[model samples]
Target: MSPSTLQAPEIAMRPALRFITCGSVDDGKSTLIGRLLYERQLILDDQLSALERDSRRHGTAGEGVDFSLLLDGLEAEREQGITIDVAYRYFATARRSFIVADTPGHEQYTRNMVTGASNADLAVLLVDARKGLLDQTRRHAIIAAMLGIRHMVLAVNKIDLVDFDRAVFERIVAAFNDFAATLGFRTITAIPLSARFGDNVAERSQRTPWYAGPPLIDLLEQIDVEDDRSGKPFRMPVQWVNRPDASFRGFCGTIVSGAVKAGDEIVVLPSGRVTTVKEVLAPGADGKAETGDSVTLTLTEETDVARGDMLAAPRARPQVADQFAAHIVWMSPEALLPGRSYLMKVNHNSVLATVTDLKHRVDIQTLARLAAKTLSLNEVGVCNLSVARPIAVDAYADNRDTGGFVLIDRYSNETVAAGMIDFALRRATNIHRHAYTVNKAFRTALMHHKPAVLWFTGLPGSGKSTIANLVESGLHARGAHTMLLDGDNVRHGLNNDLGFTEADRVENIRRVAEVAKLMTEAGLIVLCSFISPFAAERRLAREMVQTGEFIEIFVDTPLEMCIVRDPKGLYRRALAGEIANFTGIGQPYERPEVPELHLLTPDRDPAQLAQDVIDELIRMKIL
Candidate 1:
């Protein structure tokens, strides 16, 4: 063969490495990524020219092109000279491809950083050579480890500014190693580089003669990115059920772990139904279905299959339970309220769930477990979660796809927290609902009236208790069986341990709601009077009873008017800072958008308001 026509030996391409850049703000993360892209010839000529021009106009670097400008695409980010969101960039070398995520470093934007690290296989943590390690460095390390990133590279950037001192670099490495030892990373490679000058990033630098290691790009190109899932037991969460016609019925989803072939015996989870795989139709594949393959599966016999169900190897099925222990990272500005119902979405399955207990909050700085009743924004905690129905799940260490979940606020539809399953609680599987012969209908018929809950909600001094007492008196005189659950009275007994914090308030309402529900089952009209400030908790209470069995009575007294009345001198104490987290003072009271009865307390007498509630109940035929 002619020399020009000679074919070179084929070299196996390396698997793409997914990594993220993180650390304290202005630690040269963006510049490092920009320099790496430039050295790899990823930036086009016109882009380079624009970058140079912009660098001269608004860059921090005096003469050189501001490489950070390439990645900080947001105008706000450019103006503030900080990364505000996760910026993903793609590039390639001759040996391998790479997906790099540049994450924010500010504590306020920790949620954004989590988004970047969720899918990464490795992390490149940048540190200013002058500022060895900051609090943000520890936080980023903790988050990266929580997300299951096992490998890390501590890039001490701006070494040139530190005069390439070997001692300085050694101190940084030692400090980081001391901290990282607790994080459980398998490998931590520390390298000194000046990203501004492109030194030791893509090529070796003579200035760092004392340090001998491969360049950053070289290390990334050679590191193994392969994670073998073929040896694991088969697991595929059904994302969609495809039934186009009578002849075709298939379960479709991407296999998350292991492999499956035709005639393999599989078990559907949470159902325990066993069947043989009739055929595996993996589109664009030769045959069979492997991990990461999106395929349609056919069963040998007709079975009850549905979306959100799991298909797994019969011998290694996941745990099916209604409750589990999990590690959660609360991401919402509103603190996490225990006992409040939220929408928990895991894979394709979404369930009504409640954070049953706040075990403890993790201190990112010291990794200490501190007792906490609530979790604020960016706080990590261990908690118990109870779902409305049992779900098939694996520990996060075993399967990220089936064990990770997000809690969404049902009313706002906002993601408030992310959680990883640890294990199913033993009690969750042991407990079963006991069926009784005498039910709500039977009790209600005997009482000659429908069982119902009249929920009174408003500000603390909005006459909720006054109106509720009057209504209860009227019901008792009319021979209607009734029970009253005033918030303060219940607090002195059932919820005395609870406080006024949002979390405690939620638990308090939950207890009262359960009590009211039980009372209603005995055919008594249960009356609840409390400043149930949050609408979500009120909605939860309403859902416990049957339709029209729960009535929301809003005592719409203005805050100024409540403060003027100060029924129990609470507003005075709250205003004087004697009490913290008091409703309508330190804490917020969410006004009911729509209530069954909205009584403007200041405009009417207590008797009139109570009569309105009784009249409404009579009109609804609940009396």
Candidate 2:
């Protein structure tokens, strides 16, 4: 149906199908998309004119039109002439609607392909009839299968170039069908077509008179996708608040799956609070809504609901847990190791999660998953996740909205993977019991102010203390209760026993972070100036605070500058072997790659830097 036809009343409509094109770089994936769009007449007049202009501009290379150029928009992509990231395109046909994701073809960019096909309902795995089943196609199909996309259409593209030979097409089709069936992709549709010549895209080709089947578009439109979101309870993760009126705030987000009616008993996840829907609202006077509709929902009671929380029918509420096993596809260059915490984005909620164990590495070729110690980039494995807090979710097969998540490296902030949750935690691996003592409010009552921690980290003589002292004085003058934890001061008491060794350094940061955490709980702004040199340590310290508490000020003065401004002659003595294990002299300090505040030495003025930090805090509503 045309998009305009979707506006018709009293007609039961089929939902749009989301699919991805997977093949080698020159396997005609892009050409297939362009052909599909062309036959559907989706291209605007001006757009076609622009395409002609670009064709003339580029002098027209290759066997046919450079259809790959249609999706490669990045300058680097156009220059290197390869798709890197996943590119999404939307178009509708007279029979059905389509959402296509174009993925990269490079072997190294297999991670990109997994990301593209993760949310797809079907995958159009293209193959060059001339070059039957390449390793790249096999790799992509394995990932798609692992990610739970069952339906695949084997588009044997570029058959026209092969003289439209029936024997050739049949041989390639049989080989791929056998491979796909072996890989557990049962519903494989092997279609013969030439994407460049627009044969069998929207219309059945007359070239192969022997094969009698529906056109590709007919199969796409006829395929049932209602079951994708059907037979499940209502689930809509609150994405934003629509405050059309100050008196009321309506929860707004796309209905991920299932149906909801007015007065449906809804349960807010991770909280177990129950409430009935007061109204299921759309702009129009609608009776009900299915999946993919953006609507506002008002509850009976004014319960505190925000982004990163799921709203579901009370009868089918998802399971809550702090640990779960997932089939994780590693997407980063770094290896997944034990004791490293990853930032997990489960549904809309973000949590600090660590892996309990690396179960096995999935052998894509042999289909035998082997027990392994680690997973590298583009590798698939089953691993267990342990979150810092309890999260409500469901099995991926039952509910994709609640079951999928991206794992981010806590230290590097790089998204390491796309994970499909298997089931709820079999054994409770709780990070901590849900307990709120000395809450943010209670801390404010005792301290008589709002709590914040000025986390200063730098080399030994890089002016961290100088800047922190000036900032503390400024905050004190402003009637904000502030405490400055200088490394010198801490060495006299709490961290006195600690030393310059790696273990002692880690312990020092931990102690300081805990103190800062406690001070934040009491609603006091504390300034901490220490040589907390490690990125991992600093990130862990930041994660300790709930919000508006930890402020990292990186005194990024150069080592040479620190040595020159060594007020205590520590740098001079360290060079002369008097001061042992001194930072910037003997000990290594990992610079703050992304510091909240970057400040130079005292000669550049510390008071101004402190004021800048204060201003930033106020602007972020953390003051």
Candidate 1 accuracy as lDDT? 0.91
Against the unseen true structure, what C-alpha lDDT does each candidate score?
0.91, 0.78
Model 1, span 4-94: residue lDDT tens = 2342221244778899999999999999999999999899999999999888876888899999999999988988889998999999777
Output the lDDT of residue 541, model 1. Answer: 95
As a whole number from 0 to 100, the lDDT of residue 594 in candidate 2 is 73
In terms of lDDT, the poorest run of 10 residues in model 1 is: 3-12
TM-score of decoy 2 = 0.68
lDDT agreement of model 2 with the native: 0.78
TM-score of each candidate structure, all chains considered together: 0.96, 0.68
